[model samples]
Target: MTSMPVESPPKRATLRQRVFRALSGEYFWLYLLLLPSILILIAVILIPMLFAFQMSLGNTSIVVVAGRGSINNQWVGLQNYLSLLQNPSFWQALRETLYFWVVSILIEITVGIGMAALMNQSFFGRRIFRVIVFIPWAIPTVVNAMLWGMIFDGNNFGALNDLLLQWHLIQSPIVWLNPSALFPQIPWLSNALSYLGSNLAMNSIIVGDEWKTLPIVAILVLAGMQTIPHEFYEAARVEGASAWRQFRQITLPLIAPVLTVVLILRTMQLMRAFTLIFTLEQFGLPVLSIQAYQQAFAFGSFGMGSAVSFLIGLIALIIAYFYIKRLYREEL
Candidate 1:
């Protein structure tokens, strides 16, 4: 028998050859397609966030010197954060922001689910009704704020005041935007729960925000509802399940993931609510976002503003994390 020649080991791929192979691979096109978006995100979001964080750690106030202005970004090392923690106004703003977020989110979720359930049903002109429901959300935030402002105007000619006057609900026109305790008659209760005191201003803001935002929640919930199989409802009906029971047992559990997403999104949006509140009340109500705006623009305290913004972002992240964790726990 003839001895077979030993096979030579294949040469290792050079670094350049490996790189070339990767560049020519199936995923190369996908990475190339994503490059522009990644670059844009880095330019628009990541860079600004880094700059803001740096600013938060230092004083970035502009100082004028001999007809020339220069940014005084002297490192203060968490002084801005420390000062915000020590400030009573900061705490008050945080409380107001949380109050607004909680109240508005509760109302939105409840009303939105109801509206979604209604729209999910088959009825005459259901499409038209859905369109009408969505119209408020389609309206721009600034426009919505201005429209509500007119309705809630303190003047006698305001829409609400006029209606109330016609109905003989009050003897005089009410200043709807006034920041007064909701229950001044119950001083103890008012003192105990100052944050929830039904201030007309805050309530009006909530109403406007809800009117514009509720439709979004409804739409989202409706989308979630659509994903539920009609067979589920059919099976429930076969078991003689009532409408409420069907909803509670089948609809809710199935759509929980969607609701969790909605909660996270709405919480972030409500926490950063500035345009609607600012347009409606300006600096009248001190919410966290407005406080940040005032610190940056009104008071020229960019460092403080950045710190507040960073805090808001951190809070949003924490809330989102909790929501996601709970969702996973429920799934398990």
Candidate 2:
């Protein structure tokens, strides 16, 4: 043993020293790389958000006179929020927003998953089918909105209604944009038939939105499905499992993380669905975002408007926080 002296083991750094080294060592480059994005994020998101929260505490009478500046205001306290609580339109908008997300996303998730699963199978013209599905997702949101507005135009300008009429699907061009058609029969919850009709009318804009965005969901799900190993399916088949059975067991479990990611992304996307809804509201489809904009700009209830915007921001912030937490938890 004396003829072969062994080297001593390296000592472990203390936690505080390790942390100090992390702050000052090669890993400092990670922070350096993150700095620009952090600054940009602060400038674009965090600072603006702080300003909005401060302004939410103030009203136009106090803040507008001084310009949209600073983190101080006349401090309307909780008046804006209290007003929103009592405001019927705000409440209605919020209710509609919730309904839109719940129903539309239900359809989107179900349809998107089924479509992606189908597209993932070894079928003929798979590439063409994928391209077809992806085309709508590729369209600009503004353009998609505009196109839907045109399609749902209450006047004789709608291609969809024209086609329906041409195909003898209906006797006349259905005025889809009519407020009556869009929000008919307020006592819908009283009866199943009325409720179904109300749901159809209420979901007109959602239909257009689904058409525009379902392709994206499909693409995302397909990407997830593609990441699953072929061996897993092969093994399942070797054990005498059918395709559906194998998907139920192996494919679905493996793709759950991706499904969660896609869902979270779509949730955040639709929560602040402003531009499209705004354009659609031009056709009288009133979603929360559009209603908020209308209150702030069109109706000039400056306090109400700010409050509505704050509410929208609050919801989005909560969803994003939860989603990020879920992502981190899943990672762990």
Candidate 3:
């Protein structure tokens, strides 16, 4: 009985056993908890997107025959997309969309930053004013559209017209929603303002949209401002920096990230502004979203509609990617 019993090596774990071990690990429960949300995202967003992309690649349409409705889809490669590129209406809509997006974003960002800076200051009823400022944003989009629509109703009964008349601003009620009514002459200016879309109609939409969305930008900027330490301002003040200099140097740089976020979100939202435009002017101002809707429902051209929709999404992604990449680059 000289030697101890020979020791045996541990057996390797089987694949099933390894997998089971992983599933039983600490992070497994976290992944398990996220499963439902992942599944929902796939079902709701990914699946529909895939289907829409497929439809965009084909000549898809709806046909009604003998009291029956059916889909007519045919593989057409990039024909729908190509045709859309060649379409004048598509380009016009794109121009109008870009114009609206640029103008509205500029106004919103400017006014929003100003409002945020004001609100961030210590003042009487500041909290109450903040609440009141957010009320427009909280109002339902449909209701806001209706309210603005009534105000710009192109009739004497319209609130804006009524007010203007009361103030002796105009001798007669103006057709505020009429695209052609405001700037019919002025050869050079007409072309330039055509980007404004239907003159007052587009401008009216911008105003309405600004009223609802400026609050969002202001609130976000205000949050960003709050994150900044008061000591920064104090230090700047010690150096004899004026208010404008303090904002330009200290406030803006610190809040650049928040502004980036606001830009991305507002750009995407503006691109897909359908309900407000539709309610205010119906098919009169054919922005991208309305174009897609008209192509699909009005003309029964599902393929073209899907293409336009996909294009809008693609543009949004591109813009987001640009902003995010620039942000990361600046950070690094």
Per-residue lDDT over 1-332 for candidate 3, one digit per residue giving the tens place of the 0 to 100 score: 69988879989999999888878888699879999999999999999999889899999977799999987789999999999999988988988888888899889778999999999999999999999999999999999999998988778899999999999999999877776635558777887778555366788888888999999899999999999999999999999999999999999888989989999999899999998999888999899999999999998889999999999988888988998888887778
10 residues in a row with least lDDT, candidate 2: 190-199
TM-score of each: 0.90, 0.80, 0.89
Looking at model 3, residue 326 earns an lDDT score of: 84
Model 2 agreement with the true structure over 1-332: per-residue lDDT tens digits: 46787798989889999989987899899988998999999999999777766656667433344456432246788887888788776666676677777777798778999999889889889999889888988899899988988888765558888778778898877767554433335444435432232344356678888998899888888899999888988888889999789878887767778877887787777766877767666625556677767776786555556677788778877876886787667567
Which residue runs does candidate 3 get wrong by more than 4 Å? 1-25, 63-70, 181-185, 195-198
Q: For each candidate, C-alpha RMSD in Å?
A: 4.2, 5.5, 5.1
TM-score of 1: 0.90
Candidate 1 C-alpha lDDT tens digits along 1-332: 99999999999999999888877898699878998999999999999999999999998898999999877887999999999999988888888888898898889778989999999999999999999999998898899889998999888899999999999998899888776667778988776556543476888889889999999999999999999999999999999999999999999888889999999999999889999889977898988999999999999989999999999998888989998999999889
- A best-first ranking of the candidates according to their TM-score comes to 1, 3, 2
- What value of lDDT does candidate 2 attain over all alpha carbons? 0.74
> Which is the better candidate, 2 or 3, if ranked by TM-score?
3
Quote model 3's TM-score: 0.89
| C-alpha local distance difference test of each model | 0.90, 0.74, 0.90
Clashing pairs in 3: 179-198
